[model samples]
Target: MQDSDSLRGFLFDNMPIRGQIVTLTSSYQEVLKRHEYPSNIACLLGEFLAAASLLGATLKQSARIILQARGSGALKTVMAECASDNRVRGIARGDFKVCATQTGFKDLFVDAVLAITIEPLQGQRYQGIVPLEGDNLSQCLMGYFAQSEQLPTSIKLAASTQESAGILVQQLPNHAPLEQSTTDWQTINLLIKTLRAKEQLHLTHNDQLYLLFKEHHVRLFDAKDMRFQCHCSRHRTARALISLGEPEIREIYLQQELIDMQCEFCGALYSFKKPFIDALLRDQNKALR
Candidate 1:
């Protein structure tokens, strides 16, 4: 279980390629426990969690990456976010009973578009959207890289109710000769394609890479721990409420004395009473003035 709830990076010493592997156990279960999801929806959420973790490792600065998809079918929307610090949270919204009846990606998500959003702690945020044209989440991600990033990338993702795991390999700007780099990339991709779901779920990070690239010299990096953490707080939630404007706040207050806000990612609740709301609005009015 060395790989459980951890992310590790690797480099191909002989080639200009790098990769990362992520496995989730306790964190995956933590997300599942917050809301009741169908088995299939839960599995898809796991893949998204693993994918976000793998993508977060690629960021050069402190940031958070979100992998989200929206559709008009039984599966309405699913989102997973992972920060540079490896804090992860995810949610799915749809009819679970209807979602359980479907199995294929397309069936579950008709007319779906996958969006990858990166929010840096300091810089502006960026997002890329692509049609969900592939058979699985892995293929959709590969298409996104090919279309948006223009990088040769290979991704494998697998998730069961018990565990979720993913691996991402990308060919960096060519350092080797064209022919050699092409051959190396193809060789590595072929080997990675041979990886089995069972191995991805059960093997240690070292063993998994060794099993795939024993013939090549691969350098594995130290493991980084990951955990389930919701970024929601009373302050953040209050800020969100303040965005509704004074009129909206007044209207809501007329219906109820306390404004209760509950986080969808984690079930933490934030309640704002009349006095607090009044002070908050006064501060906002002063700032505006």
Candidate 2:
């Protein structure tokens, strides 16, 4: 597909290395439209969305990859999540005025902790946390890999007003001994580092990859589309209400004739009236029998 919002995976012909490049246009804009975020926070959320899509490409199950950062700085919390089906969404909550003045990672997120969570569809979940010590998100992610994954990984993330994009290159475990003189991870990383934000946001995915790895024996695969989707629905909301139980639901309904629930990710509202709540409770009770 020639769509701008797509993720492409590639690998070297000879080396034990793999990479993914993703560009977000509509998906990024969808997230921004849900909230009135400042330019800096919007850009940061875009970068996180791209990073999540890139990282989510490595998943083997119908799981999810969540990238989050929380701190006591201008940007209080940022979350980006991508499902195994390539559905992506993101949100940011923070001081917009403070974020407007910040330009650096540390400046925007002081005393921050970056956490990456991998939650499978039907298995154990995993999470890795690292201090936000780098100048940029890419560097912090590389540090996470170094400490938690013990892998040679490089990431270049960028975000603009109209689009967001990122590229990830990782050196896989070798299956056989290689000559010491062969090209190393550092060399490949240098090549990936040359990507610029303007190019990622403007250039086509194929063109961007060609510009970065044209010299290397790169094999590009078909692109996968990334979409902005929220998993929230009436059924899920009913389940949540059921978990709250009858008394809590009654109390909430008493405050207002209709209980309104707004989805943080999609801005969709779900309303529950007394009749609906009673029906839901009855259904939940029947299921418990």
Candidate 3:
């Protein structure tokens, strides 16, 4: 791999808080493997990929987190999803060719939303969509933590063809995770706001926090590997095709000789002939017995 990657969590033993730093290298290139995304949108995917990884690590249960930006701009939407297994994937929609020429944060995002969705393997899923805040993905996520979780959280993320990195700093809730107050959270958030892109992406996990809080004590934890993997297959595609309803499948069959579905994450294609479709339906019927 040209770009080695890692995910490390740190604990501030005496501060009543903990956080994570996520880094990616070739894995980012893997995201751009099959598509030609404009530089800005490519960077957006990387930022969201790092954000999703950081958020997924906070979950105690087996969960996946999806970070998405959606709006009416030339670049209509982009999404990144991270699984419990550390498998990551992302894609952008429409014309993702916009460039940011302004200096201010709000000038960058214009109109959009930062949506976080948590899906547990064996439980009901939940989603929260908040209006876009700040100029970039990091600030938008930090804004989310402030408004929704009130955790005094801050995030800084960077993306390039070679790598993607993100740093997260959040104060522990005064009460349980569910009962923390929004007032004190805002006060402590000021400290987190001091992070810069260079420090977040350049420093080591240990050094990053040490540099940020030289006056405080912090505990470091084991790191995990993060990589790119596509979770799509012919079987999955067949299952999805079955859900399309007979009418829809017939419509596809009418215009196309074979149904060829491609996986956006990995660029793998799954094509099904009419016979294969019939066999799938038969197998599905047999399995339902």
Candidate 4:
């Protein structure tokens, strides 16, 4: 079986096509434990987590990649992010009700928009939004790449109760001439098409890649660890409380006797009692002077 919380990247020796495979187990379970998600929603979030990790690997600089889907149907919004450090977190919100029949991507997310945002630690952020038109999340991502990136990309995603896994293949910019590139892309695409969700979840990374690309010249890289980490801390929460301004802070403190907050991404709790609130207000006032 594939190791949990690891991502593997590979490349073809003679072609410009590259690929990444990620399997999230402990990390996926950690995110799911924060909320009681329906089976369908949990599966979608798992796919998003894998996708975000795959995209984060492509970042040459320090940055975080966020994958979000907003829809008008039962599923309202789903969010996932993966930092350059391989820290991953995700959550989903919806007006969902479980049904006897299975729900497809289109059924749960009608008239949806899929957005991918890149936030660099030092530079301006970039975002691409596209229509969510597909039977599954993988197909929707393919459409996103086709419209927003104009890249020949293929993705396969699978989520079980215990783990989530995904694989992505893309044709790089520099390759042989257009005709040769097309032929190469087609061949790689066909090979990838043979992969199934069960195989992705059941096989080890090396075994899976070898099964798919053993006939070709491929080099696999060492796996990078991916983990469920929430960057939330009391210091950050204090800064956020200060941003709320003294009046709002005072109002909340007066009404509740304390300001309590919880990190939605993780179940960490932060509380500012009266004395803490007063100290924060004093600090803010002193900074204003």
* Model 1 Cα lDDT, one tens digit per residue, 1-289: 8878999999998899999999999999999999999899999999999999999998889999999999999899999999989999999999989999999888998999999999999989999999988989999999999999667999999999999999999999965789999999999999989999999999999999989999999999999999999999898899899998889999999999999999999999999998998998899889889
* Span of ten consecutive residues with least summed lDDT in model 2: 175-184
Where does candidate 2 stray beyond 4 Å? Answer: 1-3, 176-182, 239-251, 278-289
- The TM-score measured for candidate 1 stands at 0.96
For every model shown, what is its TM-score relative to the native structure? 0.96, 0.89, 0.84, 0.90
Give each model's whole-structure lDDT: 0.94, 0.87, 0.76, 0.87
Report the Cα lDDT for residue 110, model 3. 56
For 3-115, candidate 4 gives per-residue lDDT tens digits of 78999899999999999999999999999998888887888899999999988887789999999999887678899999999999999987656421447667777788999
Best by lDDT: 1
- lDDT digits (tens) for residues 214-261 of candidate 3: 766777787898988878888898888888876788788889889988
Q: Give candidate 3 regions above 4 Å deviation.
A: 1-3, 97-111, 174-188, 279-289
Q: What's the CA RMSD of model 3 in angstroms?
A: 3.9
Q: What is the lDDT of residue 235 in candidate 2?
A: 83
Per-residue lDDT value at 289 in model 1: 94
Q: Is candidate 1 or candidate 3 better by TM-score?
A: 1
Please give the range of 10 consecutive residues that has the lowest summed lDDT in model 4.
Answer: 95-104
State residue 90's C-alpha deviation in candidate 2, in Å.
0.7
